[model samples]
Target: MRVISGTARGKRLQAPRGTDTRPITDMIKEALFNVLGSGIGGASLLDLFAGSGSVGIEALSRGARQVVFIDNSHNAVRVIRDNLNNCGFTQGFELYRNDVFRAVEILARRKTKFDYIYADPPFTVEAIFGPLLETLDRTSLLAPDGSLIIRSPRRMILPLKLKSLQEYRVNNYGESTLHYYRLI
Candidate 1:
């Protein structure tokens, strides 16, 4: 995969050589950023289930001030590190090789808030969808006007509204779907 725009545009990123990590495709990435528009500039982002760190790197390239990447796979973390180094990103980022939920809790405890949070868990892990949304809704990890974007299989059923988060938009790209949620 490669960066679609901004300072690191055209920089080819390395993905883990296995099925465990599914990097976002350039087309979908472009569409996502298009929807995000210029709001990405100077934003702090949380990238959950950050396989290969593609989405986080894209945010960095597009001028995000900071990005925190979380994933449970050693290989994914290694690939993310190599990709970040390759793009000459020496700062404004954090990589955590831990479970996404636990990392969220730690970030919450630190009173961290992000302008945007992107999650792309494996489609096979459908069980995580509910708890993930609930945890995020209960924590202070999301800024008051921040958004949470989740990528999942188009066929997977996700909640339209939670206690604090409400689904505002849904975009479909082939078999994948991007669900956008915001604080109610």
Candidate 2:
């Protein structure tokens, strides 16, 4: 995959050597950043299920002040590290080889807030969608005016409203869907 825009535009990224990780396609990534607009600059982002770190790398390329990447897979973490190194990104990022939920909890406990949080768990793990949303809703990890963007199979139905967050936008891209939520 390649970065679609910003400073690192046209930079090719490497994906993990297996099907365990599903890196976001360039088209979807482009559309996602388009929706994000110029607000990405100077923003702090949380990338859950980071995989190849494509999304987080894109945010960094577009001028995001910092990005925290979390993933549970060893291979995925390695690929993410390699991708970051290849892109010459020496700073403004943190990589965590941990479960997304636990990582979020730690971030919350540390009072770390992000301007945007992006999650793209494996489609096979349908069971995670609900609990993931609930966990994020219950935490202070998301800034009051920040957004939580989830990428899921188009057929999957996500809740429109949580206790503190509400769905504000939805975009469908082929078999994938992007759900945007913000504080109510």
TM-score per model over all chains: 0.98, 0.99
Off by over 4 Å in 2: none
- What is the per-residue lDDT of model 2 for residues 111-178, given as tens digits with 9 covering 90 to 100? 99999999999999899999999999998688988999999999999999999999999999999999
lDDT of 1 by residue, 66-166 (tens): 99999999999999999999999999999999999999999999999999999998888788888898999899688998999999999988999988999
Residue pairs with clashing backbones, model 2: none
Candidate 1, run of 10 with poorest lDDT = 121-130
Candidate number with greatest lDDT: 2
Instruction: Name model 1 segments beyond 4 Å from true.
Output: none
Whole-model Cα lDDT of every candidate shown, in order: 0.94, 0.94
